[model samples]
Target: MVIQSGESSFGRDSVTRATSPFLPPPVTHRKDCMSAAVKRYRYLRRLFKFEQMDFEFALWQMMYLFVAPQKVYRNFHYRKETKSQFARDDPAFLVLLSFWLFVSSVGFTFVLGLGVYEFCKFLLYVIFVDCIGVGLCVATVLWYVSNKYFLKPNYRGQDVEWGYAFDVHLNAFFPPLIILHVLQLFFYHGLPILHRTQVLLYPLVPLFLTFIVSLASGWNIIRTIMDFYHYRV
Candidate 1:
């Protein structure tokens, strides 16, 4: 009787092991992992605008802004119609490019090279001093001027979003900034210093051009906002 009982107990143990509830099926485990990965990928796509702007389109838009400002502006509307309102025209590429140009300009200023410490300091100054303070100050002025002057004539009592103003300002800055840096690379190095107080001539041209273009685009941008509010331009 004892031997028979032992054999029965062993059989029960084998059955339990074979059909354990804690052990997930192989196919189920793979599906769960794949689902998790897909979810993560979707989240990333939304956060970064990965699906909206591809590499070629991004390059074309930035270049097109100079040659055809009106066309570029129109493209923004097309994107809004097709994509969500939150989908922006410039995307992450331009923003990254702007920062790259700024840093490269600073680095190129030093003919030799930068040490680890100096490089770190330059980066900090670019972010905090140049980008945060100066960039914000310029954008704020653009926003204020557009709202005060242009929008009032067309769309009275409607306030323009700072985001729109900032985007326009940043994009306007890119071409001029690139031109200034190119001058810095070639001409600025060779020019003789006239006086301590006088501004460098090579960069002044591009800087002035940048300001004019920014102002004009700013007006157009305000018009866009007015149109968005259902007001006639």
Candidate 2:
């Protein structure tokens, strides 16, 4: 009886150990999966924070560029022309204008080169900056044309009524300019200077800026034209 009891007890102990191995492995696997998930989440959170910081920095940089001495010089020169026709017809003014046009064109070409390089190198931040630069170039061109032809003619009129024509022109120019400038802040300054990552995000910056400018321009044109029509009647 003692021998039989001993053998049965040993068999029961062996069965219990066999089942315990299977149970522990499943529990271990679950723990490992959870740990991996937690690690991935943390990594993603850090990446997002980094990107946000980059964007903010880029924005500050763009503002600084826009308000720099060169920008002031340009603005003053343009405004002076509007007030005094002397500056308008001056050969020097044309030379300066030509210089600016050439500079801007060169800058735009450089931006394109940089953007392509960044895209190839997988540097997202640089790409974004390039995009912003392109947008600024476009905005500058639009501003020049609007100021030279549209705003100047109206302001030059001896009895220029502050009527629909004036309103429409201002409306058309200001809204698009503002929108493009805002986009420039995001694409050129925010993404590249701040984040310093040359990633896919850079390309989107230009596209967004362009979209905003186009939308604003279209809306302003329609609104201004409608206002002029109403005033005429």
Candidate 3:
């Protein structure tokens, strides 16, 4: 009888142990989930604010960078197409490149003539001009690539339309030149008072403008390329 009782007690304990694992415990608030949700909300809010600030800043900067100058040099000639099938053999871009190099060299020489007080001024001018020229050359190469591979069908009226690509290329190429010329006039002609702070800020304005324009243009190109790929697929 004692053995039977011991066996019965062991079986009951075993049954309780087995049931306890399967049964749900008393309800407890999950602090971890609540904390994670709060973190996610705060992160999203921060991201939204950042995006808004970026847009506002870019808009303000772009207006000062592009629009004000447009009023001054509205008559400037902008070359839209440097290469087409009819002009495939033309060396116009090469000539333009050579001309820019010569002009840049002359500018550098002038900058070199200035004494210590004006060295920074000259250096800033040269840097801005060179960056603009380099950007133009790069835009030309991208234009050619787009024309050859991406725009060919549109040119032939076969299927693809790359009008947007052409427009983007044009938009990307012109601003740098405009900014360069504006800065050149601003510094060389002494239109703006040459405070030390102004001198430093002046070059930065154009450089920043160039950077933003390039970024926007690159984004457009990438989107277009992706669209083309998607369409082809």
Candidate 4:
């Protein structure tokens, strides 16, 4: 009787194993989607290696750096512990981010300005002259800061990476650029439409927010600079 009972249990186990799927259909689909996303992210990261250390993480770090630069600053300095050095101190990342921001500002400028065409001549000029010029200026400024400030004598012997300086400068500059673009958006249309509606005061909301963001960005930059100074000396 005991032998028969054991055989019955074994038969049931085999049947269950044969009928049950390894994973539910929803779970399998989700896993496959996640894997594909990871693969795509890796491919993009490799393609843009110089400018984007990690495609997704860089965006998040930029967001964090704007809001909490000190944390990102420290993480960059102490990379061994934090393992976030790539996102913060990648030279290509800085160049690309700076260029991206510059392009965004330029695009917004074009949108806010007269929607007129100059036989593609003015567009070419803005793309080649204004965008490239602004990008180069940002790079030069970051390079200057790297050499002038962070590379100075360090009493604590904590070495400063040039890339980190660039990262800090990029983060410091991003807020003002972003806020200025937003302000331009409101200044361009919101006020004009509100004025037409006779709602003169409503337009101040976006302007006020932009002003506050600009101030916050400046403060964040000051905090980052102070942190760098402390790290230096």
Model 1, 1-233: lDDT tens digits are 11212223322333343346675432322322323345335535654675554545556556766776665565544433332221243355445655666666465647437776777776677656665567678878977887788775655735444555555666676677667654556655453655554464678899788769979877565666678889543
lDDT of 4 by residue, 1-233 (tens): 11212223323333343335662332222322323345335545665465445444455556766666664454443342223222232343445565665566556657756344542455465445544455456756766765567665753333333344434556666676566644556555554534456567788999788769979876565677799999999
Candidate 3 — what's its lDDT?
A: 0.41
Candidate maximizing lDDT: 1
lDDT of 2 by residue, 1-233 (tens): 11212223322333343345443432222322323345335534554354333333223223434444343233323322232211111122222223333344345445556565544443333233333345445555655565566665546532222221222232233334334433343355453445546675789998788769979877565677799999999
Scored against the true structure, residue 113 in model 3 reaches a CA lDDT of: 67
Locate the minimum summed-lDDT window of 10 residues in model 2: 85-94
Q: Write the per-residue lDDT of candidate 3 for residues 107-200, one digit (tens) a residue.
A: 5446446564465565455445554445456656775675568755445532222332322333344456445643464456454554565566
Ranking of predictions according to lDDT: 1, 4, 3, 2
lDDT of 4: 0.50
TM-score for model 4?
0.41
- Candidate 2 has a TM-score of 0.19
- TM-score (all chains, Cα) for each model: 0.49, 0.19, 0.26, 0.41
lDDT of each: 0.54, 0.38, 0.41, 0.50
Residue pairs with backbone overlap in model 3:
none
Candidate 4: clashing pairs of residues: 51-92
Q: Can you tell me which runs of candidate 1 are displaced by over 4 Å?
A: 1-53, 79-90, 102-106, 109-112, 152-158, 191-233
Highest TM-score against the true fold, candidate: 1
